[model samples]
Target chain A: MHIPFDQLKAEFKRVLLKLNFTHERADFCAQIFAENSRDGVYTHGLNRFPAFVQHIKNGLINIDAQPTLINNLGAIEQWDGNLAPGILNASFCMDRAITLAEQNGIGCVAIKNTNHWMHGGTYGWQAADAGFIGICITNSIANMVPWGGSTNALGNNPLIIALPRADGHVVLDMAISQYSKGKVLQYQSFEDELPFVGGYDGDGNLTKDPNAIIESKRLLPIGLWKGSALSMVLDMLVSALSLGKTVKQITDQGNESSASQVFIAIKPFNA
Target chain B: MHIPFDQLKAEFKRVLLKLNFTHERADFCAQIFAENSRDGVYTHGLNRFPAFVQHIKNGLINIDAQPTLINNLGAIEQWDGNLAPGILNASFCMDRAITLAEQNGIGCVAIKNTNHWMHGGTYGWQAADAGFIGICITNSIANMVPWGGSTNALGNNPLIIALPRADGHVVLDMAISQYSKGKVLQYQSFEDELPFVGGYDGDGNLTKDPNAIIESKRLLPIGLWKGSALSMVLDMLVSALSLGKTVKQITDQGNESSASQVFIAIKPFNA
Candidate 1:
């Protein structure tokens, strides 16, 4: 249960290479996955690896594909992820953004056809480590009901804002959902009821029971209507900026592939 | 009680002139105060005007002062607000940022020694209407306790993000607090319990009583510890970017003047 970090990364790299990933792609992605676990983000680390591998096997992720730029408008660039692994594609895009910012003070990259990047904080940390202020967002499959609505129709899309500091890079990464589905699953795994009402029950009453919430699939968005509006706005921004599929379109695809994401890097003036 | 907008603005204008404000300054400040109320932010508009006037009278806000540029590095500029009214200083800074973005792809302006911007969304809408993505944030007097700390040591600092949209111009203006102090006062006026647990009682148990919360000054930050961390990180970013006062320093001020803020504008690719 507590494998060494290096072993975990090596295993991921082995699997990815066996699946035909290029040497560079397997090494970079496997390192990120291992780092997520070592840094205590279990949901996106070891636990997520199985689901990630499954997605690739199911053709939701294309191991050999990479992000390719499609449009360039001043400091903004649009790219197609080519259904690539989200972690690799995200890193590639942020690198591009950083390069552009180094030349133009600020840069933005929007990509479509991305898979889940796992923990969003990784990208923020990457940018901060590069001496840039970074903001990143991604639109996911709808697992949350819009506020004031009883149906599931919104994504608990995460937002990350990081500022480079001499001390630990200040990073704020949060999902619009009060409790993400992974968090609920974690609580259920521990056989613990959530301390607060995480979502609604099948009968439509707020409930703390993690199992009931997972069963009902009525995850509560953060701050009710506030988070719903935020989710919609973030979705619109990522989709519009990337000129890619919206959440509605992503869900209609019947699989959570080809999602859209946006990454921005602002070169710190002082840096 | 429904005052004509012009009459309300003119009355404010009259007071600022009496206080020796320049003609342009008085009119600019008065117009924003009136527009805030018209846009349904009465808490920061008419209701707060008396206190704002009192601050000037008490010499808390420096009526004759204006922001002076401290540094300009690439597209980022830093200003010292010279203890001016937050609304005036913030508008000017955002305007400067817009000018920078017009030249470059993005621009940032961070200000120190400012007072509170009555409505953060006002500046956000300003940038969105200019067809750019806008973001702004401000640190406040400490009013919320940090996570795991019973005493207040964090500002319920507001963060605003707006994207120019074809419809509605998606703007999110939110404080880290679950319910802002002004909102609690509104609930108290109606003799109503907060619909949710807005803060902890004297004994640190969650409660809905607006009176108790206001008395305690122990407002709950949104998402419990999540917002607390966010507010802290935001304060750090503002302080670092402007090389200005931190929340700790602002709290040490006898009253809530001389706060710091940051504004950023990024040109959309399409434009």
Candidate 2:
């Protein structure tokens, strides 16, 4: 229950190596997973590790692939992630964005075919560490219903904004939904009601019962209609910029693989 | 109450001409003001026209001043607005940004010493009309409190995002506050409580009473803490990018003149 951070990372690395991950890939992915757990994001860390491994074994993620350049538009670049691990693809895209920003004051990089980049804040922190303003967004399998709709038709896409400061970086990571599916599951495990309405109940009314929301599979978006519109636009932005799969397309594929993402970096004026 | 659009534009043009505005300047400003009224944003259109005249009469607006180029860094440019009316300065900046974006795939223009641009969506629509993605933000006088702080130390900055579409452009214009001061005032005039809590009462408790919130002058931010952080960052972003005055400095000057703003435009991939 209280394994040391190093031990946890070692175990993860060992498992990935057995799954045919290269040494460098195993080490890098293991470090990220360890950091996620250390940062208290166990949902995307240890808890999701088994599912991640299963996905790889199920041929949903291609571990040996690398992102390939799709287009170069001066300060903006587009890439095909080639279904690589999300962490690696996101990290590489942010690095490229930072480099472009250094050259042009601002840079945008969009990638398609990436996996779920666990802990979206990681790349935001990466850019802040490099002394730049970072903004990123990613789509996922549809788990949220569009405003006024009864069925799931939208993803609870997350947006991240990070600003570098001399003392500490300010990073804001938020999902468009009021509460994520992981959070609902957490509350369900405790048999607790949400403090505020998180989604609709069976009768199509707003409710605080996590069980009702989970059963309905209709997580409420932040600010209701506002969040719905924002999510729709963000989905368009990422997909159009990357020339990649949209949420509808990803949902139809029956897996969360090959998601689209966008990363942007701006070199601060003072920097 | 039901004046024709052309009549309203003509009235505005006549008044602006009498206030020493050049024919071209008066015509441009009058058209935007008329469009604002036609688009149902009467608060910034006809309802605000008398205040605009008063500002001009008080010499708070420099009728003849034009924005001057400050610096250009390839895809990014900076300008000194010379305390010109915000509409002209914002329009000029967006035009420059669109031009840069067309040449380099993306462009950013930051300006200092501009006034209020009235409805911020004007610039967003401007870019969308040009078939590009537009993003714009502006800092204003402090009106909202920061999260965890009791005093008003942040501006309810407005952000605009516009995407060009074949059928119709999608545009979102939002202020960081849950309800703008104008909206609160309107509710007060109607003797109605806000549909949702807008801000705090004198005792620092959240309330839906428009009168109490107006008296307290403690406008609650959108999403509470989330919007506060966003407003702070946006203020920093506009001021830092323009190398201009922050909200604190602007408030200290005792008027909302000489504000800072930024406009960004990106060429859509297909474009």
Candidate 3:
């Protein structure tokens, strides 16, 4: 059950290379997936590798596609991800954001047409390692219900904030939902009820039963209306900034691809 | 009980002018307080006017002081609020942030020594009205307990996000607590238990009794550990960016006058 980090990474790289990824892309992605597992995020790491490869085989991820420049403002720029691998697009955007911050004290890069980035905290840690403040957000397919709504009309968007410190970086990565779908699935697999109310039951009342929540597809927001409104605004912020598809559009497209995201970096005066 | 908006603003202006506020400053502060009431936030409006004036009379808020530029880095700037009225300083900073964003597509302004800015959503609305995405955060005196800590060692720091829309703007202004101290006080005064568990009792168990929470002073964060970590990182961010005092320093100082805050504005690509 325990594999050496390098061995896991090498296996992932080998698979990716066979899937038509370039040597550099495979290595970068393998390292990210390996680190995600090392950090205990198995949901996005080894467990998710098969689905990731399936997306590639389905042509949902255009490995050969590159992000194209859209608009270049002094401190803010917009890009079109061109359906590229989320890991590569996100890495490139964060790099550009950091570079712009170096030149202008703060920088913002928004991209459209990106795929799922797997773990957003990767970019946050990236900026923190570079000695800058990082803030990023991404809108996903609808997996949550808006506050007071019975139907799923919101995405469990994740927000990341990171700051570099002398000892270690402080990073806060959070999702708008109280429980992620992965968490709900885990609870269901164990035939266990949630410790607290996770979502609504068939009667439209709060319930701890994961099966009911999963069937209803009404995952609760973290702070009720507070998280609901936060999710909506974050969606607007990312989608509008990138001039990309909103949650509604992405949901209508029937896949979680071509998402909008924003990456921001701020150069600390002295850190 | 149902004062007209202009009448309420005029009354606030009358009292502020009597406290030696300049005409412009008095008008601005009064309008903000009045709007707070108009928007149904009476806690920071007519009901909180006496405390606002008391801060001025106690020499905690220097009505004559103005925000001074500490450092400028093109798209980002640092400012010293000079113990000025929070409403004025916050407005000035947001205005500068918007102006800078207009020039560079994104801008960030961080300030120290600022007082309470009434409602954080005020600045969010200000930026949204100026056709920009606004994000702001401010550190306050410790009022909530940090995760795994029983003491009130974290500020219920508020985060604000706003986006411009063809319809009404979407704004989210939320503190890190499940229920703010002010809300708990309101519930206590009304002799009502919270609808949900608000905080811990003396025995360190979650309780809905407002009186018990008030006595224990262990207000719960919104998402438990999530909000605690968020409050800490936000504190670090505002303080580090502005070179201002942190929650620890503010709590030790025994007053909330000299607080740190950050305002960010980004030009949206399109509505």
CAPRI tier of model 1: acceptable
Against the native complex, each candidate's DockQ, computed on alpha carbons, is 0.42, 0.53, 0.77
lDDT of 2 by residue, A1-271 (tens): 6989999999999999999999999999999999999998877899889989988998888999999998988999999999999999999999999998888888889999999999999999999999988989999888788888988889988988888889999888877777877778778989999877888888889899999998988888775666677788788888988989999999999989999999988876667
Superposed model 2: Cα runs more than 4 Å off: A190-192
**In candidate 3, which residue pairs clash?**
none
Please write out the lDDT profile of model 1 over residues B1-271, one tens digit for every residue: 6889999999989988998999999999999999988888888998889989999999889988989998876677889999898899999999998988887767788898889899999999999999988889999888898878998889888888889977778888888888888889889999999998888788988899999998888888877767777789888878777778888898887688888899988787676
Ranking by DockQ: 3, 2, 1
- Tens-digit lDDT string for candidate 2 (B74-161): 7888899998888999999999999998878889999999999999899999999999899899999888888789988899888888
Taken over the whole model, the C-alpha lDDT of each candidate is 0.86, 0.88, 0.90
Interface RMSD of 3: 1.0
CA shift of A174, model 2, Å: 1.5
Better of 1 and 2 by DockQ: 2
Off by over 4 Å in 1: none
Can you write out model 1's per-residue Cα lDDT over A147-224, one digit (the tens) per residue? 778877888888888988787788888887788788898899999999888899888888999989999888887767
Backbone clashes, candidate 1: 0
Number of the top-ranking candidate, with DockQ as the measure: 3
